[model samples]
Target chain A: MSERLAVLKTYKLFIGGTFPRSESGRVYQVTDAKGGWLANAPLASRKDARDAVVAARKAFGGWSGATAYLRGQVLYRVAEMLEGRRGQFTAEVAAGSGLSKAKAAAEVDAAIDRWVWYAGWSDKVAQVAGGANPVAGPYFNLSTPEPTGVVAVLAPRESAFLGLVSVLAPAIVTGNTVVLVASESAPLPALSLAEVLATSDVPGGVVNVLSGRAAELGAPLAAHRDVNAIDLSGADAELARELEVAAADNLKRVLRPRPGTSWTADPGPERMLALLETKTVWHPTGSLGASGSAY
Target chain B: MPSSPPQSASAASPLADVTASDAALRRFLHGLPGVDAVGLEARAAALGTRSIKTTAKAYAIDLAISMIDLTTLEGADTPGKVRALSAKGVTPDPTDRGTPPVAALCVYPDMVAEARAAVAGSGVKVASVATAFPAGRAALPVRLADTRDAVAAGADEIDMVIDRGAFLAGRYLEVYEQIRAVRDVCGTARLKVIFETGELSTYDNIRRVSWLAMLAGADFVKTSTGKVAVNATPANTLLLMEAVRDFRRETGRQVGVKPAGGIRTSKDAVKYLVMVNETLGADWLSARWFRFGASSLLNDLLMQRQKLRTGNYSGPDYVTVD
Candidate 1:
């Protein structure tokens, strides 16, 4: 009997909700731990990185302005989509990382839970991170947390699924749009995740995913004046320091990778809080009289 | 059909002695050559990447500031608002008196008098949008009356929108005649013909309308009415610049260009300047030739100017809201 042929999927970069081949029309090969050939990932160039930043910046206003409840709903929807695509993610993760089926399934499960975890923090981030201040003057001063515009994230290479989700979900949950560079070698899972995101209620450009070498794509984003922040969770120490310096051009909030960090650990609010900015507003406390005079 | 009948070497006005027949006019416009959308867009995008930094950037920012026609065109516009806009136009950067005032203050025809009075003593020109403005859907007489009101009310410049419906319906003569009539009413004030290019739909149409407007005696062929879904994009403005450039080489008359909408940031304003500088050379880099029709854009330019001078970014609180 003739064997049925398997149809392989072509991986494309996700920018502005569309799956487009790299602007440079270049692709790099992805392989498993045993060097088994996978799909050719888009080798995104500086131009692609710039396009992604522009998209993220464009999506920043709508996403950041959305009510915390709506953002939470969108994030939870992303989790739901990821959950539905669990089998696809598990297979892709195993193939990409050469992990055992059980281990890959566990990683995929953790990633889904990570999204759900960050989804809950979407609404409560402001409450936990901001409060009213008691000033000595006759004034009502309240500080609220606001997203720091567009973020450029370098997803971890080793634990592709869990690490990518861990970095992405936190930044986007609190309303910031992100341009993420997926795992260089094990990028199939991230590319698959893009499909999940596109199907979810998450807006286009809110979380742009690029599959390429981290340094190649991360440099332009790090130096882009329009980018408000960056996550270097995947960069080596040397690359991290270089990116941190480049990010200073616009003073982007840099989240350096913690050495020997465990992707499976329950990440505290630090990642979400790191991407946020506190805006303290002061309003005059007028007297309770019809004259509206200050106390 | 090589060119538009080899325009008169020394025509007194832009439309002094051109084709008088509809066939000739259509042939003249249609014969001006079609624009290759891809090439034109690529050229505009390429020009947009020229990085003007440090001293050159500082100079460009200030030059862009002086070339602004700070405008407020809303149905809800009040005399008080016009006065405030006029004041801002006359002194764009209040904290630093050294900053140059914008070239003009653009308003509606009815507010021209108040706008004129507000900037009476200053050299800031009062530009009024006339000829039914955002949409030039009125009769010729009514449109001509609108132009006359603005011109009589002391408008140094009159920005009039072309009848897109007429132009799109292939009624070239009606659109040309309307612009010519508006030009006659404008008299001394410069006539800025708005193509409302967004409705024109294609780059080819934008190029043709540009030449048609210039050939109809437009002192400046402007893009958009600042009221369309897409207004005054870099590619559209670049095409208009190309038209002005070619028109001058053909007719020996230099026309100005104005890109009037959705251009808000200092970066965006500078990119347009780059397009103007490279496309038209240094000759069209002055306030007399190139103008930005925006009000909020001035504040952003001022903030950038402050950033350049003070070595730190300035917030909106540092500049006036208007």
Candidate 2:
């Protein structure tokens, strides 16, 4: 008897916490290293990108307003789910990048660990960034860091699993909602990661993953006036330049890509800090007990 | 048991003569037409894609501002809260004095007097939500009294909710008579009937309810009470707009439409305006014909308006809390 046929999965874009085919009904065939057909990734249109930004914007209020401790717990839960699905990630990473099974497994483990690293940073980011300031006047001065609302990210194609986690973990850990364009060629792993995120208690629209050409999806997102910031760590020089210019329409906070930047290196707090805005508040400090300087 | 009563002799009420009997009303409604849900939703979504940008966007923002029925229907509402909402309504963007006052201030019956006093000389009409507001679970006598109290309290406009239980239970005549009775008690006040379409559960029912309200002498047919889980959606609003357009075509008299609840953005408000523009034409684009039943939506519009004028994005703190 012939061996049972493997049922191939159809990958859809994750937008607004639901899996929907592109409104344009366009999809591109994705293949493995040996050119074996893997899945059909949705060729998301400009409208799809705008829709994702809308979703991310809608989710910003709730996700950003959530208690820091709750966000930390939810991010940690993502790591737990990713660890449970380690073997699946390993297979996809291997099939997507033509890596050895052992190497792919290591990448998956590292990706899961990256989530854990950022999960712990969620609550600490506020304390590390916010503090009282000494002013000469009779006023209490303090500055607090706030999330810069909705962000659009172009995920690196080279390190689909690790690099995707590297960019996504920090943006969301700091309370900003994200609309990310997945690696154009090796999008299967990113699509699979969306499933993990959906089950990991990550709010829908909090992190939307679109699998398509980077420029097509990224252009609209960059130009979207509602999008507050953008990360171009994955784009090539030409596309990155174009996106950065388009992002200027709304004066979006941009993180430009540089050559030879390693995704495997330890990501610093800069990734989290880059997406936050400092808001300084001043309140008049009255004389303590009717006596000037009671102490 | 359907009652076949004698037809009244006046043309003042077109529905009064046609719907003389319960069976006649049922036949008239069910035979009005079947609603194509997909077609309605697709049309609404398509209209929403209109890019009212730059110069056109500025005009739409102001137009939307003037067309808003700045509303507060909270159970926890107080006199002070209503007064604040009224002040915000009269001058939405206090910093930008060029900003126009909203079309009206909508509140509950009890707060109608306070809202009226708050917006006294601003030319901002006071609208009161009556007939037990979000729910029409009260008796006919009580509901009529509720409408009378608001009208007596100087409410220029009365927003009354239809009894969904009666309409859903095939009590067409009862629903029609109730609206007529409320209209009678409203005296000179314009009657805006709330269908609470979410509870009705189907586009066909929304269409029927809209016509039922209009035929029974409603000055405007409102979408929701701003209290239902699902209120004033684009698809439902579009369906109601189409009904008013068709109603005018069939009967020479024109009616207005107000969609309340869940519309909390300048963009959503503009989309509804686009729907009104295309579906009902420019005639319904004014405050006289169309209005948004929203509170937070006004501030967002103000913020967007400020952005357009100043060329910088503004935050919530820049706008008033109301």
Candidate 3:
């Protein structure tokens, strides 16, 4: 234990199964709840955001291309891992959010359950929310919720662990890879969450967490033409407005911050649908269908 | 079991009164501009020949029932009352289950957690009214925060009343931006943008509000808060349903329709169901597609169902169990 503790493993940005520091090589110290030095997290730069976009884009085809059931299985696996680490998160959240032990445990459980909930939704969203469209013509039309490509999330500052998990799990479970800006004041649990994801069967670059000032890193991610959507959850007023404006550059789907609310609320099916872009396909069905289908 | 004065003197004619009511309503609606040209014609075309059924699944039930009112529930002393109603489920024994259990349980920003907890692991979802709710008179920042807080608190859905004051003042863009801002905070939660039809004061306004909400990314367009006297009516439901149907035709996105407020009986619920089925078709039968927003209507539905199943009519006292 002493050897492992003293070894000083350099935590690098997890992108495409490779460990790399920010192109700027900027590192910021993340502190624990008591403001004690915990570890140095990458102060991801604009280039790093771009790099994450590349990694996410690279992984998107294969990840989103998989069957919804397969995605559900992978997400379920992540939920299982998250459940196993519930205690660790409870302790971290207790310290991070200044919540009571019981409250922290409940939050951790809710966060884990959220993961499970989203895991279940991965395969069923289309069935419940999307279906065949009865068009006037002979076209076999259907509408389905599809991943909106690489998503960039700004995890909420409060309710650090749960918020981060809530945003990330939903995004990834729906096959949208994410670049998350971990809560500035509380980045420990986020990195810890990342560690869990690294081991959980979640593909590399499916989620990339960076710990730094939101304005410093978030703007690039929001404005990045490659990114499809920007979830501005933890950003403050000024930052949220700025990100909202920047998101317009690419017309990125922007999710503004929720007012003073925590992520412990019952998440309905809306979050999953929000990150989704509905694609209605119209396939012209002619008279040839009956003859080919007949026995 | 006592019918209300036979709706007329004739006991054999159940729908004679309805026909008269329909005719009167049609005459009243026909005088309004564009209504006679587009709205009335459209509504008549849709409601033609389809008799309103009495069962829970009846088309009339949908039209008549306004599931639950979020603003009223917000002020209710026992926040869990709606949740309990939802917990009881839609039972056939009106006397046993009280009201039919509204289509959904509505609550406030903080109460979403309580509602969700009470209705946890149940079919009924916890809905929170946000974006300053009934008034929609708040800063954009405040409204966005309110919406986000509700979703974060575990609200399965959000009912955000539009800034009618702004809309009425012709600040269309402000109203649009407000809805869009709330839509942003909604994240993954379903957003039902309320037009506050009573305040809008006209069918044309209702139509415009419905289009704005749908175009601005609303998953559902809702009518009235039930607080206002001029709540959801068949006329408003008809207009909004047409708008929703048209929006679907144009965008291919199936936005849901919720006619809330003033609905209080199984009979009312059947009316709304009839309107939806006749106007929107079979696809709108599910809870996801359609919802009633009345608190008392659920009991009425239950009572009616029980009466139908057991051949014994229960009084209102026995039906209003919750």
Candidate ranking under TM-score, highest first, comes to: 2, 1, 3
CA lDDT for candidate 2: 0.88
- Candidate that would win on lDDT: 2
**Candidate 2 per-residue C-alpha lDDT over B1-322 given as tens digits, one digit per residue, 9 for 90 to 100:** 1111233356565455557888988877886667777887888899999878899999999999998999988889999999999999988888899998999999989999999899999999999999887788999999999999999999999999999999999999999999999999999999999999889988888878887888899999999888869989999998888888877866778999999999999899999988988989998889999989998999899988987886544555578776
Please report, as a residue range, the 10-residue window in candidate 1 chain A with the lowest summed lDDT. A286-295
Q: Write the per-residue lDDT of candidate 2 for residues A1-295, one digit (tens) a residue.
A: 9999988788999999999999899999888889998889999998788778778888999999998899999999999988889999999999988999999999999888888999999888878999999999878899989999998999988998999999999999989999999999899888888898899898999999998999888877776777889999879999999989988876899999978888888988999999999999998877765567743
DockQ score for model 3: 0.00
Candidates' lDDT values, in order?
0.88, 0.88, 0.73
- Scoring the B chain of model 3 against the true B chain gives a TM-score of 0.78
What's the TM-score, to 2 decimals, of chain B in model 2?
0.95
Clashing pairs in 2: none
lDDT tens readout by residue for model 3, A1-295: 4455475546566666556787788888776667777678778777677667768878888889988899899888888888888888887788776789999999888888888888888888889778999999878899988899989898888888778878888888778988888888877788778778888777887888777788988877776656888898988999899889878865779888879675777878877778998899998776556567522
Error of 1 at A101 (Å): 2.1
lDDT of 1 at B207: 79
| Candidate 1 TM-score restricted to chain A | 0.96
How would you class the docking of model 3?
Answer: incorrect
**Best-to-worst ranking by lDDT:** 2, 1, 3
